[model samples]
Target: MSTNKVIHALYNDDDILMDAVKKVRAEHHHIEEVFTPFPVHGLDKALGLAPTRLAITAFLYGITGTAVSTWLTWYTMIADWPQDIGGKPSFSWLENMPAFVPILFELTVFFAAHLMVITFFMRSRLWPFKEAENPDPRTTDDHFLMEIPVEGNEDELKALLESTGAVEINVVEKH
Candidate 1:
């Protein structure tokens, strides 16, 4: 079995991390991943990642909820048992749409929120009892860590990282 070598660079501040990321990219080095204590705005764009499609999925889920709620309201209030509550027994969904507005809005929000969370978890490959992938616990507190695969230029990479204000750097082998 071949072992892959990677360099883990730790930084103290987010600003330094961002500058280091830009410099690493400028040198055509591929960054495998970055870990931070909190979200850093514009990091995804700096990493050259594509825009997420979660919003599109959310909209579709909302539409599905709307359709389901519409059908349910029609079947129960109009087709199955027409009730003459509020002095209106039109028995038509269109005529009684105002009454179903609340249900439609509520179900739409519910489905969108729930399904979006599920989709995010699935897409991220997150599951219960999964082992953590973080290389350093310090990154979860106040440090930032950047993982980069070593491509045979260890000395050059080390120099580059050191110049970028990395607080610490380590080389590790992964199976």
Candidate 2:
């Protein structure tokens, strides 16, 4: 239930769009979002967004994977049935830990990668069969779009958009 109106400014090139972002931020106007044809370097910084903490989450996931692997190895190899691996069997997991290193590394990487993807999807509101929220389809192909919530001064916003070299500007009302 958004009753706000937004100004969608389209840019022909990412370079120009980036400059527009800087100018808009400098004025203290709130930019709702920006869509780009491709990844633009420093766009996040220009938008004043906080850096992502996914790496930290991934590290935690890796540690969980490591603990799981350790438990599984100890239960299966040492507790249930003990056997000589590489002719070095003291009937203990510590003696056979060298052989488990590869398994630990693989499981850690697997958990980190899969959990990171899932976390990204959940955070972004992206899921299977979910309709995309792209403001303009052209942004996916060759254009960039910046969505700015309109306050009272629509004329001033339009003028600023023009000076920033936006190819097209549209004022849309959303319910």
Worst 10 residues of 1 by lDDT: 86-95
| Candidate 2 pairs with clashing backbones | none
Q: Tell me each candidate's TM-score.
A: 0.96, 0.95
Tell me how many residue pairs clash in candidate 2: 0
| Deviation of model 2 at 106, angstroms | 0.7
Computed on alpha carbons, the lDDT of every model, listed in order, comes to 0.94, 0.91
Runs off by more than 4 Å, candidate 2: none
* Top candidate, metric TM-score: 1
Each prediction's RMSD over C-alphas, in Å, is 1.1, 1.2
Report, for all candidates in order, the number of backbone clashes. 0, 0
lDDT of 1 by residue, 47-147 (tens): 88899999899999999999999998999999988899888775678989999999999999999999999999899989888899889999999999999
Across residues 1-175, which tens digit of lDDT does each residue of candidate 2 receive?
Answer: 6598999999998889999999999989999999988899999999999999988999999998899889888888888888776687847789789988998899888888899999999998899999888988999999999999999979999999999999999999955
Off by over 4 Å in 1: none
